[model samples]
Target: MTVTELAFFVGASGPVTAEGTEVINQAIEVQTEWSTRNAPSMPQGRENRGVSFLQQIEDPSVYLLTAHWASVEEHNLCIAAPENRETLSKIPPYFQVDKIVYFHLKDVAINSTSGKNGEISILQSPIISVGRLTIAAEKRQAFEQAWNEVKGILEEFVKPNVVKNGWRLEKENETTEEFVLVAGWPNLEKYRDFAQAKDFERYQSVLASFAQTRDLKCYRRIL
Candidate 1:
């Protein structure tokens, strides 16, 4: 039920940098105010969620906001609130949000070398991957076998640049039969090259043979 992450990507068309920052800062303030004021009524054990924004180094026009929520019901309640609605309405003039994508994060790795009191350093920031695949009832085994092969390549040949990587099967409660891959990378260029490589394409072909439907995307942390 946890909301591991909710990512909002700012699109190409939007206000200039200074204006966008102003809008984001305002949104943060409003969200914080609302959360605090409604804490008593908010779902128990879910009031300590956090949000942050990250900007892509290669593409300044694109930025991401990631929020961690306690549960799906809490997220729904927050979105449906009148104050939250008002806050969302005021954002378009300053920023264009592509889609509010949701994810359930799996913590693949954490480095505790910093040795500070509860001050863990993020050696590599989070990366989010979203995808959906066709699932055939009778061909599940075949599909799994193919996926395993591709995963092997990913682990051996593709994951060196990834500081950490892991995949999760989606919940039956969701609308789509989506599977998510979460990874952390030292650099985006390395992940970009790995995705477009010939070997990766070959891996995809192998997967496509068994998949009747497919959707895929890759995202880097901006906030």
Candidate 2:
């Protein structure tokens, strides 16, 4: 099944205090509860699959809030709901909104045990390296082919400690076709080790050949 992800980028206007953090966390919990409750009946027969709140370790004040839905239409339905809008309205006062991006990513390739019963928690590998890219229009097919190869290579390198290495594509067309790759590692030490390895170099080389624009960042799961 395909998943639609709504990503919210936000940061504190100033240094976030203990109280501010608590408020943000509570707000997220409430929002998730509401969404989960309304998921089954949402438009387009959508389901609220999951929700996560991530904080950027490099910049503690910055955060990434992601919610997974059955499809893009379902996500839009939730957004259009008055209750959902009300919950969302409560969030902005707590932080400075940066930008919001939506991705309708289908899991094209994954490990055998990716979505099996024994799934690793975000807390296990709190650090997630997120790579976002826009593929050159003419090279889309080639890029996807290269991605399949890259996924196989990553399976060999980022295993055990690296619980998840997921690749997803954006359904909507921007200036170019967009994709996101999220690699989860136990800690910065493990992540750095993988990055410095030869396999990572190969991965980067393969990506560079077809990627028109690439942006990479790291974030820690806070909720």
lDDT of each: 0.52, 0.60
lDDT of prediction 1: 0.52
lDDT of 1 by residue, 135-172 (tens): 55567667667777676655444343332322333355
For model 1 the local lDDT of residue 77 reads 74
Tens-digit lDDT string for candidate 2 (1-223)? 5463637555557445666566656655655565567664432211233456677777676666665555666667767767656656655666665554555566422122455455544435567777778776677788888888777666555555333333455445645777677666667887777767767888879988878788877787666
**Model 1 misplacement above 4 A:** 9-16, 29-50, 54-63, 96-123, 126-152, 156-176, 193-203, 210-220
Off by over 4 Å in 2: 18-27, 35-37, 41-48, 108-124, 161-175
**In model 2, where is the ten-residue run with the lowest total lDDT?**
41-50
RMSD of 2: 4.3
